[model samples]
Target chain A: MNYNWNWGILFEEPYFDWLVSGVEWTLFVSAVAWIIAFSLGSIVGVARTVDSVPIRAVATAYVELFRNIPLIVQMFLWFYVVPEMVPDDWGRWMKRDMPFPEATSAIFCLGTYTASRVAEQVRAGIESIPVGQRAAGLAMGLTTVQVYRYLLVPVGYRIIVPPLTSEFLTIFKNSSLALTIGVAELLYQARQIENYTFQGFEAFTSVTLIYLVLTMIVVALMVSVEEKTKIPGYGIQKDK
Target chain B: MIMLGDFDFGVIVTALPYLWDGMQLSLLLTGLAAVGSIFLGTLLALMRLSSIRLFQWIGAIWVNFFRSLPLLLVIFWFYFLVPLIVQGQVDAFESALIGFVLFEAAYFCEIMRSGIQSISRGQAWSGYALGLKYSQTMRYVVLPQAFRNMLPILLTQTIILFQDTSLVFVVGLADFMTSAVTVAQRDSRLVELYVFAALVYFVMCYFASLSVKILQKKMHK
Candidate 1:
């Protein structure tokens, strides 16, 4: 009840700059990580459903390993433990010379972790295509690789757009965890402002709104994609 | 200077007690929050399903508001805001617990809502035909079936809650992950401790997920 509320402090010179930089880092992490997730997830998801047993097992292992561990733990493992586990020169580079080591580790961590979830969605999207679709593709004299390239990948990606949008949004949220390892992302900057100004409420409130807005923007963009790429009477349309 | 050859899981052996204590707290938080959220979630789900417009709005807002923000932010908000509101210091652990329960209740609400909806309307109508009140039908007939239907998903969500308990590290809670880091720091054995923690989590969550997969398969049949 005795709290001093200062809404203006958030827009103050250094704090405002901090907020912008924080958002820049957050977007950077999420965007880069998403590239990794989308690519790796596609490969892994396809691998899981492939006819090759060993390939399927390897993809399943990849998903299980990454998905089972907590993101923070994975982040810590990547940032702290991984350097030591590698050779000495690589560890030195990671610790000292690599560009934005904290952020880079975070990108990889979030990327691989989300990739597992994305892989699941991708597998679901692909699997939902009906056995007949795969059979028909094969029956049409298409090779397995050709079938995926020409038919499955394009259609499967479209089918899973909604889930992928949420996954992309999640990477942004997960990027906040990078702060634990000293990445100056949005959440980290919010805490920095709170530390300097003691305006914890305002700092957090602003950051929360920023995250919500970011999420809304992603939803809007993806919804457009969904609308543009509407497959006539195929793929499940989940209620928003 | 450390190499893969230098990996000494002996650190885990030495730090087992601390890690065990931390694991206990982690499990305790996950268990408590899971149970609390399910109860709150059930209420919210019912409210959303209720014919009353105000209850439906309240339920919808609660779920959407929490879902829209990151859990970490919510935890930070509770940790910082509650002290100011009460004009007193709030325990970090308690704040984190409150944050987890409230935030997780939102997710559980959606799950429960879907679970309830999945139950055929005819079943509810049958209960109504048997001279039962709306509340009675939900209590005796609808909820039990919903719980049965969603047990695997509930367990899967609980596993996620267990993983999430590690996030309390930001607020200085000595949960399992934090404990491993603590020991790793004090002993200067970061590699061993982190890998051990990852393995522990991997073992528990992997098997749990596998079982959930099996349950899903069985249910499908």
Candidate 2:
């Protein structure tokens, strides 16, 4: 049976609102999760490199545990299991009083999951720097914290712009998983549009275009950042 | 108080056969998809690196498009769209396998391209100096070394592909995740089953990653 494609149906009132809000929530979820990933990953990543053995081991274990588990399972555990695990009143509060609880849980899950990835990047970035710099900082009487804060972090972050850019794109794609937990993001909206209209192809096609556009924008932004912050010889070259 | 009686290992023991069946399907998909994508990805990498503009454009567009989109969306598209394209009823298993191979070919292509390009230009030039054709040089000289160099990364990606196999649950395939969910709901022990599933996933993935690490160290050594 041939299918009659009505691309215009996506632009209709209710469907259009679904798509728009889907985009908004997708962006909102990814952006907030990125902030969480960056901050938490930075701490954990720095801790991994610290002189303290116990701190480093704990950080490493955190990365391994989070990194190894699939994100969807993590989302389920966070969404369905965690609330039930908590105190009775808190669980009720989560179910009732929490605003956009699904979104909150998705953010938490995605952020922490991506944080494991980001932590690895951060650790690699710091390690990529010359050991002499750390020695130089110490020679100048800077404490370890001051050394990382003033010297290692700035250079390492810059050095890792390319990887971080890829990580950002990854988180955006991963945000799609939030749909499984009923966040009504782009994929979820597309599924809704499909269920409503039986126009699976069109719904998925439009949302795929939005994803492509989002990733392109991220690529462009990150490339420009890479260009501006690139050190003379440390930046990645295309054919080198 | 959460009672120990509520958490039943006996239920998990009963569900083990079905869950294991699902795990087999998941592993089968990952294995097939890995082989297919690696073969196709290698071809795409060669096309991208080819001198022909048309080949380069085709390779670039395919890679970029799939790379830009989420794997879930790709799975959805193939699940719904391929049957229409092929004018035949494609089973859920076939659709998921096709979607995975196609989508992952894009990523694997990029990885293989980088691996191939990482070989020094002089190596390719020496092939030319020996009067070997481009394809022969690639087949004989370049690809072997490139594959060896890229084995660790390729395995790491395969582990990721293994994790991603769980996404097949979206299409209603009885993969591990879906099977666990089914059993959990059927048995009314969501917590125990999910926890068990997560443990299974974590153990497998952690071991795979550890192997990749070991492989990387061996290669470096």
Candidate 3:
């Protein structure tokens, strides 16, 4: 413990900017990936529960493929392998296309991988709703899509809220894997700062604290939403 | 598609020695860390459930701090920081093992806590009525049941840990991923080498999951 500790580096202008930008990227990636995960997860989840056998098979395949693969591999594939698969012109286009293409690929990989797990949560939520609701909608001469749109989605979302929150937290953590692809996200920024200053403790401690803050904010938001949409006497009864 | 057909198997053949060497370190790290984490995690779980507020608070914070941070960060912190504090040269593999134990302990704490909590409150009370001290009750009555209930989930977490060992490569440990990357660098076949590494990971994880499923069935009966 005799090593000199530098606390002032955190408040220095350049390092502060790095930290701020890192937080922004982290939040940005999480928010975008969450939207993709929820939307795609709902679609795939509903598909799995559909009456059509073929559709269910396809949905199952999607879930099994993605869920079984590690998130790091998926990120590497998206960032490295899939891009190589593109036609030469298109590959070049993507390579030169944007400034933050690595970030975009990371978002795509993280979001899609998480969506598979979210799909299971969605399917479970929808299935938990009594079949009678769908039956009532059908008996009213509603189309299958209409039944889902009007009846299934609302109730299913409420039921899936807690698990979805967990998935969101996961996506936030998985975003750190983007560091492997050289994206200057929070973790990457921390590494950069560490290498530059050789102040490993300060840099990592700052990164850890940032992640804790972000996750806590996400938990708080999810709790508020859960409270707002809660159905009385349902899942996860509140402790007095 | 760049065909994998043109690849030379000699790379893998030559790489086997290195892979075997790395596997020893990987398995050793996993085994040691698994044992350490389980013991520490169980202690933390008991502390969290204890009647004393201080114990509960300390346990909660321990779990939160380690669980929320990325495993890589945890590993890097220990790998870099421990030497500074202890003023001794720690090797890469030992540092990685220490990191894995600390990081995995947090997760194991959460898993064991839930497992213990799943048991009805009456079970503990029944132990108390039988004239068991708190520690005796936990050891004789509570833990056996909780461990049984948690065996499957615990196995699943082990599978996760197995894959997580790959992250140790970041700290320059010559584990599976590092060995693969080393071969890839020498042969200039990064994609195929990484794919092979992925296959190795998949097989290990898949078997772990299968064994857990079988164990779950036997335990239920």
Best candidate according to TM-score:
1
Error of 2 at A93 (Å): 2.1
Question: Which sections of candidate 2 miss by over 4 Å?
Answer: A236-240, B1-6
Stronger candidate by DockQ (2 vs 3): 2
Candidate 2 chain B — worst ten consecutive residues by lDDT sum?
B1-10
lDDT of 2 at B139: 89
Compared with the true structure, what per-residue lDDT tens digits does model 1 show for residues A180-225? 9999999999999999998888999899989889887888898999
Per-residue lDDT tens digits for candidate 3, residues A1-240, read 575689899889899899999989988987898888888988899999999999999998888678655666676677766655666676677678855889889889888888888899889888888899999999999999999999888888887788777788878887887887777888888888888998878998888888888788888998999889877655542210
Fraction of native Cα contacts kept in each candidate? 0.73, 0.52, 0.29
The TM-score of candidate 1 is 0.97
- Candidate 2 per-residue lDDT over residues A130-150, each given as its tens digit: 899999999999999899999
- Which of candidates 2 and 3 is the stronger one according to lDDT? 2
Model 1: C-alpha RMSD to truth? 1.4
Candidate 2 lDDT, B55-88, residue by residue in tens: 9999999998988888889888998888988889
Q: On residues B69-120, what C-alpha lDDT tens digit does candidate 3 reach at each position?
A: 7787788788888888789999888888888888899889988998899899
Which whole-number lDDT from 0 to 100 does residue B120 have in model 1?
A: 98
Q: Give model 2's DockQ, 2 decimals.
A: 0.58
Runs of candidate 3 with Cα error greater than 4 angstroms are A96-98, A236-240, B4-10
Please give each candidate's TM-score: 0.97, 0.96, 0.91
| lDDT of model 1 at position B18 | 89
